[model samples]
Target: MYVFSAQRRAISIICIYMTYPYTTWQNCVYSIDRR
Candidate 1:
């Protein structure tokens, strides 16, 4: 159970790391579209 929980945490961290940049890029594009 502990290992499973650790894996879940790692996946969550990786997902956040991956999404953070994409989300920022999306926001940047959205702002550009507004201009």
Candidate 2:
């Protein structure tokens, strides 16, 4: 059970890292469009 929980946590972290850049870029584009 511990191992499975750890694996899930790792996957969640990786997903967040992968999406973080795209989210930041989207926010930047939105700000530029507002200007």
Candidate 3:
């Protein structure tokens, strides 16, 4: 059970790291469009 939980946590962390850059880039595009 501990290993499963740890694996789940790692997957979530990886997902967040993967998406962070995409969200940041999207926000930058939105800001540029506002200009």
Candidate 4:
């Protein structure tokens, strides 16, 4: 049970972090595309 909970916590953190970096990357791509 402990292991399962720990894994869920790690995945949720990574998912949020993934979104942060991905948005930055998308903005960079969009700016270059507009030019």
State the C-alpha lDDT per candidate: 0.54, 0.54, 0.54, 0.54
Model 3, residue 17: displacement in angstroms? 0.5
lDDT of 1 by residue, 1-35 (tens): 13436655565556566678676544543454466
Candidate with the greatest TM-score versus the true structure = 1
Q: Estimate each model's TM-score.
A: 0.43, 0.43, 0.42, 0.41
Which scores higher on TM-score, 1 or 3?
1
Q: lDDT, candidate 3, residue 6?
A: 66
Q: Which stretches of candidate 3 lie over 4 Å from their true place?
A: 1-4, 21-35
By TM-score rank, best first, the candidates go 1, 2, 3, 4
The window of 10 residues in a row where model 4 has the poorest summed lDDT is: 24-33
lDDT of 3 by residue, 1-35 (tens): 13436655565566567667676544543454466
Superposed by TM-score, candidate 4 places the C-alpha of residue 7 at a distance from the truth, in angstroms, of 0.3
True-structure Cα RMSD, model 2: 12.2
Considering TM-score, which of the candidate structures 1 and 2 is the better prediction for this target?
A: 1
lDDT of 2 at 13: 60
